[model samples]
Target: MIDMTTGNPGKLITRFALPLLLGNILQQTYNIVDSIVVGNFIGSEALAAVGNSGIIIFLLISMFAGIGMGAVILVSQFFGAKQEEKLRTAVDTIYIGMSVAALIITLCGIGAAEPFLRLMHTPEGATMEMSVTYVRTIFLGTAMSFGYNINASILQGIGDSKSPLLFLSIATVLNIVLDLLFVTVFDMGVFGVALATIIAQGTSFIFGAVYINRKIKIFRLFSHRMRFDSRILLQSFQIGLPAGIQNLLFCVGTIVLQRLVNSYGPAFMAGYSATNKIDMFVFMPILSFANAITTYVGQNVGAKNLDRVKEGVRSALIISVSTAIIMSILVTIFGRYLLMAFTQDAEVIKTGEEFIKRLMPGYFLLAIIFTLNSTVRGAGETFMPMLASFVSLLVARVPLAYLFNYIGGRYNIFWCYGAGWFAGSLIIVSYYLSGRWKNKAFRFVEEAEKPKR
Candidate 1:
């Protein structure tokens, strides 16, 4: 784990963010590959089916994904304060709790799959059937998904991004091979897409487990010394619940928007899905810096180096905003090619081109939201950042999407994204400048001076 509290802010961020950026890129690429194989080999209807279930899966996953973010906050602080024992405890507790939680969530997800799709007014006939099948299959692998994310979060919490990067790299390549094998060779259809992802995620979890056993002496599974600790679990959820709620609410807003998108039919759904895959890559590099800042700020906050934390935030903004601007231009230029990479259908490509044009230009605006929110979340001041998501989704994005859909029709639905980004960024930036997060950040190190259990 790297000590981020002592380095030059720019260099520290760069060093920390590159691995995360590449890992995120690879993750998104594999996701894109799934769409490519599904869209090309299976058909646009299958692509829409996958897209139709995307928000539901995310909504379910967000229930515990936020806990991983919380783990990072606590783990980074413990590492920063040199509380090795507490750090290990936090890691072990998070893993155990998430494993159990994953099982519950999986059961809930599979049970709720059809109802959730029905509520979303998922397209009828093949689209609805495929969506249900894909989600149920993916839900079955929820434990593996949770395992990989929790372990990776533990790695990131201690400022070791490279281990997760290595594991993800292996999974990405394996996922592609499996995608082709299942979808093209075996003709398994949408179920193939879900199965490939599960296999890759399960493999990555195994790799992470092996690496931890070998390298992290403190993280052995089921060691008599490594029993569960309720306090650490509470601490993790305390910080993580807001993040989980934010993602849940954020997905809630997307589900709302998605229902509207569904109104436009399967063609638009396939188009939007294709563009969404490309969009993940677009924001990923900038968001990686945001994630890096979270670790940097978490360590600094724990060390009580508030000034250094401030400097790190500023440095991250500079790098992230610059990168966003560059990416915006590139996406505008090559948006068509990116869309074409997913599907060859003329209508899908044209619809995606329009969405990309409206959306990519505002990514620079969204960069501020990501960076500021990450900084605050790292400091354990997640409520306000969580509030920003509510504003972005409910107060701004969803309403705008519906209004546009009612008045201007299909294309104007894209404008809501830019509007939401601008509004959310403004709210988060105002909070950052108000300097309230400094007040909210708990002295985690001081509080946990005496390790529990």
Candidate 2:
């Protein structure tokens, strides 16, 4: 674990972000592998099915995912404050809360799989069936998915990003092997891919739990009763609920957008799916910097090194924006080749290239928005970030997508992303300039000095 409370802001943020970038790349590979295998072996229709299900799966888990992020903020602050007992309690509270949430989401997701797909207007017959099968299989292992994420969040909270990367590397390799085995050898199709994902997730979770129990002296997973501390749980929800709502709004908007994409037919859907995987690579580095800064700010804020927090934000923006620009150029130049990795369909490749070209310019705006929002959230001011997302996704992007679709047809839909990012960046920049988030940071410092309950 590296300490960001005392270091050169630029070097610390870069070192911290590298492993996170790699880990996110590996995590995204799980879906990319599934798409590539299904698109090649099973066909485009199957690929489209997996892609459609991916959005729904994200929608299903997004709320808890946001809450898990909230837990990360709390843990980082506690760890930085050297509030060892509070940090342990926060960790335990997170696991207990997430376990219950996983069970509930699993039951609801399995039952709602077909209905949600229908609502999205997924192509009838084979595509619909495959989507439903894949969604249900994935939901069945929601606990494992939640477990792995919880472990990762706890470790990241403590400034240990590399361990999660190691665990994810294991899972990614295992997932690829299983994807080939189940899809090619057993002919399990989409079910095989989903099963591979959850099994790999379960393995990583178990491995992470055992590793933390033995190696991490500050905490233990199985050594004590996992119970919620009311104070920490309430504070977590206070910080997390807005993030959860923000994610829910974003998912709702995407679901609406997916419905629109579905109307364009399965081939277009397949193209869009492939491009989404490529998009993840473009955003990975920016997101890694955003996450790195969040922890950096949280630690510095806890240590009452507010000047370091300011320095870190500037360093993160420079690094992240430069990286974003580089990624845009690279993706624009070679996006067609990347699209071809998923399928050989000329139409899918053409459609994906068009999407990439239209969307690449907006990534700069997105890097700024994400980094700024992450900075505020690290200071324990989550509501403003949530509000910015609301304006960007619901108020700007979704409405503009439909308006553009009506005005210029399906190809115009991609332009809405830039508009949304612009809208979000405005909110984040204004909030950052207003300097209100520092007040939130000070509040956390005061809380840190209170006697442990």
Q: Model 2, which residues run further than 4 Å from truth?
A: 448-453
TM-scores of the candidates in the order shown: 0.98, 0.98
Please write out the lDDT profile of model 2 over residues 403-439, one tens digit for every residue: 9999988888999999999999999899999998887
lDDT (Cα) of model 1: 0.88
Where model 1 places Cα greater than 4 Å from the true spot, the runs are 450-453
- Give the clash count for each candidate: 0, 0
In model 1, the worst 10-residue window by lDDT is 218-227
Give one digit per residue, the lDDT tens place, for model 1 in 1-453: 788989698898889999999999999988888899998998999999998898999999895889778877998998888788888788778877888889988999999999999888888899999999999999999988888887787888788999999899888999999999998999999999999999999999999888888998745755677657687777778889999999999889998888888887888889999988888888898889988999999888888889999988889999889998998899899989888887888888888998998898788888899999999999988898899988988999999998987898888899999999888888899999999888867556677886545
- The number of clashing residue pairs in model 2 is 0
Best by lDDT: 2
Minimal lDDT window, size 10, model 2: 442-451
